[model samples]
Target chain A: MSRPLLVILLSIAGAGSIVLALVVGTYPISVLQVIETIVAPAPGVVHDVVWQLRAPRVLAAFACGGLLALAGALLQVLLRNALADPYVLGVSGGAALGALVAMLLGAGDTGVSFLALAGALGSIVVVFGLTFRGGDWNVYRLLLTGVVLSAGLSACVSLILVLAPQAQVKGMLFWLMGDLAYAGSPVYAWLILAVLTALAVAQGIRLDLLAAGELKALSLGVAVTPLKLAVFFGAALATAAAVTLGGAIGFVGLMAAHAVRLLGVSHHRALLPLAVLLGGSLITLADTAARTAWAPQQLPVGVLIALVGVPAMLWLLGRRN
Target chain B: MPGVLSCRHLRLQVPGRMLCGDVSVTFEPGQMWAILGRNGCGKTTLVHALAGLDRAAGAAVELDGVVLANTPRRRRARDVGVLLQQEETEFWGSVLDYVLLGRFPHADSWTGFSREDETRATQALETVELAPLSARRYVSLSGGERQRARIAQLLAQDPRAFLLDEPLQHLDLQHQARVLARFQQLVRDERRLVAMVLHDALWPGRYCTHALLIYDGGALASGASREVLTRANLERLYAAPLAEVSYDGGSYFVPHV
Candidate 1:
């Protein structure tokens, strides 16, 4: 797709999904009613539902969706594997472990988020330490470390849940479903920082030569050591932010970025930017469907993404093969 | 400083393996030197060590006597260029874009490209006869066209020395000749030197000034290509019948299969 066209489509689609999410609530409102609620003041019931209730929820969905996509895109570039989505291998598990431990220690919701970020970053560092040393880093070792760490975190989350207070434990269950129910615009503000970090990652498309294999990237002056460090940290941090705030949303990164690459866009320079736009738009649409499908009650946006993305991806795959 | 490259006491170790042990060599300004060897005899390893891409425990290599090992990375790139074996054509860039990546070392930190760099890159593409295809996407190119684009990238780097590993692996005979002939001209006109590893001996005799046959473990012979490629050496190197026949002031080796 042309860059301008992709951008235009995303803008139109994203705006449409957000508006649709706001209007199609339990007590459905007409387009004029929704427009008036947004632009002017429709006092009383319509006003409360539009501004206070649905507005925050929709913004949270957008933010979370964007974060998942961004994280996934960064990880795909760093790991050099199409199958490597943000939630795959264990980054989300690592962050969830951090949040779980903090919550167990009586930290507030915000503190759990901070803990989750720390946990994700720490696990990445540990994985690097365990796997990297000699001339070429071992890919299999890195994957093994991720799997082990993920399993360990899952165990810890389970153990803590086994021993926690009933109220706190119940809260953790809802949080783990990857929902955007209690989330709002405040979390969206934090996600802006995540997107900025992704913008920093935009510099890393110079790494395509490195992805061709190490020596080639270096010959092109991509500085292999520095690139590895920057990519690992950049991808991991972006992923952590999403996992902490949104829970582990599966396959957003893996499927979307790979789909972009499968379209014959091999270089990260064009591929990452396109993947970012597509991922953000896809998540926005998915979140809109999740909220409006059941009126007053909301299905978790993460589940909705899986339900929609998988079938769409399979169909795309079928067309390709 | 005027000629191609020089090497002294280079040793390379990999965890438990010693890839190249205590090697010293120097390249004349504008000639091709061929290193002939078997699979594990460390031809590519030696190339990487010399290119300064692989960190080794050996002695230093200097490009134009600048001690490239200690020089800043950006400066090192300005002096040395390498053409590796792998051909990854799906770079998602135009022929111009891929070739221009050779100019990356010269890029200013912020903006990343300069007009001078673009001119050099376009000239390089022209030199490789890829100027007509500059706007074409890299993925759309055939293998031979992609090879020329890669060579064009190295040319744009405009280094004093070229290090290539298996440079003629996949090309047709015509492309192989074009690539080799152009490389030979780099010495005559520009005084740039190239070090290469070839699967055949006749290419070095035809275009290279120096031929160093590495057999068993180390340098077997080093001199002008004609002097170094003897029938006795060919018998030992390939363990087959090789007759050196000469015609029209050129030499070719024919193997009896």
Candidate 2:
């Protein structure tokens, strides 16, 4: 398929998923009601359900998905590893530990989000400091550092989970598994996604060159050190924003970029937008299914995404080869 | 449009092994230099240092009488083009797109490459005889084809000086001669500076104006091709006896078993 056609289809799917999320909730609102609520706002049960409750959740899911996938794409390039994801740098592990500790401390939802963001930022700074020691961008060292830190953080998270009270343990687990129950607003998520996406697209050509190889990129006139720094920080910030908003969601980051590439779009110029759209749509639909799959007993959206995304990605990759 | 890429009192080493000792050379326009050395003698290392991608304990390289280290990466790239010996690339772009990346130094950073850049890339592919495979994935190409693709990228770069590491690694004899002839034409017609690390002695003697022989033990010899590429010097450089044969008014060295 042509690039524009694929982009159009992904956009349509994204729009459709948002509408599906609004209409398929426990309230049993019709699609038309969801459309009417969006097109012409009025103070009614449909408006209250669609605008007040589902809008923020759906938008947050989309933004979080976009952010994670974008981060994943950038990290894949920076580390030059195909399996590199947003959380490979231990950012999400740090965020998970923070959110769980907040729960253990009897903190509110706001406190959990704040601490998660803080933890993610801390991870970003520390990893960057250690990886860039002696002012060199060593790809293998960065990967090793991130993996070791992630393992350490995950162990701490497990310790906290084991020590927490039974009542708070469930909430902690929900956060760790990624829940959108208290994602009050997606303003920060959208802001980070928009700014990062624009910046990434603007540097798309350079990113493409960087993917070729660092020495090759430098020889071709790229400021490789600065570009690598920018990519690392940009991916970190995107991951931090997503973790703060939607907990430690998985699969979207790893799979979305791969999906876009499997569909024959590899250039960053085309890859970034299509991956963002596909990721947003995938998570929006997955969240919708998570909420309504077993009505009144919501499954963790992260679990649903992994369960669906793994097989889909495997099939896509398997078919390609 | 032409400039000198010269290094002053440069020391190149790899850990405990010294590649070269305080080697100073000036590569002027209209000069095609062939760097000959045995394996693991740091021929590639010297190229990297000259390209300003690496700096050992020594004076910095200078391009057009300006310090290369202080030059901005984009500006330096517009002036010098380097072809690395080995590639650790995960690039999934088409060959045409891969070649077009060479035009990046000239690109308008925000808007990407121009139509003229595309034309240059396509023409480069045509020059390398990879035009038919322009749409193929770069990684999917054969070894020789990928080497040609890299050469195409360097051609598209169109820098004043070309520093190529082992430019004929995977080429067949036909391609080997053709690529050398192309670089020879580039130097003769465009007055570009060409410096390449070559394993074979025949092509350099045929095509190059000057030769820099980097022996293994921190020894260096560089001057006119005829002066530096003697059978005595080459046999010592490789630690193997060689038989010199003159064919078509060109001297060729063959290793003696």
Candidate 3:
């Protein structure tokens, strides 16, 4: 596909998904009704359903999806590994553990978000402390540390599930599987996504040089140490924001970045934006499908994300081969 | 004064061995220096040290009489360029894009390269006879073509000094000669310094004005081609070998097998 065509298609996909999510729900708002609510507001069932409930939820999902995909693309270049994802560094694992604990204590959604945010930040600090030593960023060491930390944290999560009473298990599982049922506000997520994406895109050339190798980048006049520090912390913060908002949504980061690359967008400038668009659109559509798939008995959006992203990626890869 | 790269009382060592010891050398413009040594003699290590990509313990390399370690990386890169023997990282861009990265030190903006940068990169590709493969994916190129592409990238860098490690690794005989002659022309015409690690003793005598012969056990010999690059020094450098073959007022070393 030509670059412009891909851009147009992705933009249409994003806008179309948002419109579809706004129009399709339990209240059965028509497309015309959705347009009317946007153009002229009234205090009624349509306004309550469209503006009060679904709109914020849809926006949150979009912001979270963009954040995760951006983080994934950054981590892949930072580690020079194709398999790197937002959760690969134990940020989501920590958030999951924190969320499960909050649910077990019977705290409300706000408390869970707060604790999850704390846990995610804590994970970032720990990994940053361990991997950065002697003024050097050890890329492989960071990977190993994150993988091990994730394994340990997940073990703790499993223990919590086993020890908790039967009643709380389902809720805990839903949170672990990523429930955006009570995503507090899209405002913070949007802020983070916007700032970080702009920063990453601005450094696109340096990022491209970095993917070649640290020494190679330095030889070409890049300040490797500072750039690595920026990328590491930026990716960790983005992952933290998304995990806190969406309860550890998986595969959006990995799938979106790889999908963009597989579509032949090699440069970071084009790749980052396209990944963000594809990811945001994907999660919005997945959330819509998850809620309406069973009508009043919704599946976790995280599960649907994997379900949708995995097959699409496989199809993309298969077509390439 | 601002164009010389030199080291004073430098030493390099691995865990159990010393690569080089107490070696001091100065490289001036308009001369191509050949770093010739057998495998494991630390030619790569020395090039890396001179480029300031790696440190030589307690010793600092000076470029224009300023410590390289203290200089800002971008300024150092503007002055010096290095090509490693091998790179483990994978690049997914086109050959032209790869070469354009050589102009990075000259770039100031966060946006794309300027038209001048693109023109220089294209000219570099043409210099290496790779203009036809400019748009080809870098990874898809054959080994020799990739080697040529890297050479083009170094040329595009347009640094004051070039430090190349085994630059002729995978090239055919024709490419080897062509690449050597290009570097020679850069030294002669553009007055750019060129230092390359080479395996063939014959090419240095024919093409180089200066040579550094590194022997095992921390021994070092360096001077003009006549003084430091003799048949005896070549024998000592390799610990095996040689017959001196003269052709058209130039000397060449052949390994006696």
Candidate 4:
């Protein structure tokens, strides 16, 4: 497919998934009713259900998915490792630990979000400090440090879970599984997603060169250190924002990037945007399935993402092989 | 002052091993220079240091009499292009798209690839004789095809000096001659300096105007090829006895064993 056509198709798919998510909840609102709820506001239960409840949740899912996938793509290029994802560097683990600590302290949603971002930033700094030496960024050291740090953070999370009261443990588990009930407003996440996507697209060509290897990028006159720093921070910020909004969602970050590449979107300019669109659509569809698959008993979107993403990724790899 | 690329008090070392020490060389335009040395004798390391891809603490490389460290990376890239010894096999894209990356230093913006850039890339592919594989995935190409594709990328770069490490690594004899001849032609017609690290002594003797022999723990002998590539120098550089035979008014070194 041509680039523009693929972009248009992805956009349509994204919009269609969002609409389907908004309409396919337990209340079973028609498409006309969904449109009516947005266009003409009525002071009724339908308005309360769609506008007050479902809209923010659906938009949050879309924004979080886009953020995760964009971060995944940037890290994959920065590290030149195909297995890299948003959480590969332990950013999500730090966020989860921070959110859990806040939850244990009886903090509100905003407090938890702020702490999660802080935790994610802290993890980035630690990983960078530990892995960087003598002006060289060793990929193996960085990968190992991040993975070990993530394991340490997971222990902290498990400790928090074991110590928390029984009543709060269920809520904590749901949040860990990426429950979107507490994603109050999608505005902040969408703003972050837009800004980071713009930045990534702006540096897309450099990302391509970096993927070829650091030596190749340097020889080609790319400011390798500065570009790597930008990608590192950009991906960290995006991952933090996504985890804050949607908890520690998995699969979308890792799989969406590979899926777009498998579909023949090679250049980062097209790859980044299409990855975002595909990621957003995947989570929105998964979230819709999570909510309505067993109505009134919502499954975490992370579970559904893994269920869907694993098979899709396996098929992609299988076909490529 | 005599050459476009010159280094002073050059030194390269890794941990306990010294690759090159106190080596100074000047490379002028309109010359094809070859660096010859045995395996692990720092030939690749020396080329990388000259290209500013690796700079030790005291080593200073100057391009056109300006300090290479002071030049911005993008501007330096406009003047010098280095083709690495090993090509990364993990990159995913069309061969043309990969070559178009050479236009990166000239690109106006991050997201833009101009018409002129595409023309240069296409012309480069044609020059390397891989125009038919322009749309093929880079990872799918054979070793020789990939080497040619990279040569195309360097040609598209069109830098003032080309520093290539093992430019003929994977190519068969025919392609090897073809690529080296292209570099030789570039030096002759365009006055661009082409310096490559070569394992074979025969091709450098045939195609190079100047040669640098690295031997015996950071010792270097450099001058015109006919003066520096003597049979004795070749023996010391490789640590093997060589039989020099003149063929077609040129010398070729063959191991005596």
Highest-TM-score candidate: 2
| Model 3 stretches with alpha carbons more than 4 Å out | A39-44, B55-59
For model 1, what is the error of residue A210's alpha carbon versus the real structure, in angstroms, after optimal superposition?
2.5
Docking class of 2: high
Using all chains and alpha carbons, the TM-scores for the candidates as numbered come to 0.85, 0.97, 0.96, 0.96
CA displacement after TM-score superposition, residue B163 of candidate 3 (Å): 0.7
Alpha-carbon DockQ of candidate 1: 0.40
- Put down candidate 2 lDDT per residue, A1-321, tens digits, no spaces: 678899899999989988898888777889888888889899988888888889999999999899999999999999988899999999998899888888889989898998898899989888988889766778999999999999999999999989989999888888888888757579889998999999999999999998999889989888888899999999999999999988998989988998988888888988998889888888898899988899889888899999999999889989843
Give the clashing pairs for model 2. none
* Model 1 superposed RMSD (Cα): 3.9
Per residue, candidate 3 scores C-alpha lDDT tens digits across A160-279 of 999999999988888788778868898989998999999999999999989988888878888888899999889999998888888878899888988887787778988898999999
Docking quality (DockQ) for each candidate: 0.40, 0.81, 0.74, 0.71
Kindly give the number of clashing pairs for every candidate. Answer: 3, 0, 0, 0
Q: What is the C-alpha lDDT of each candidate?
A: 0.72, 0.89, 0.89, 0.88
The candidate with the higher DockQ, 1 or 3, is: 3
lDDT of 1 at B97: 75
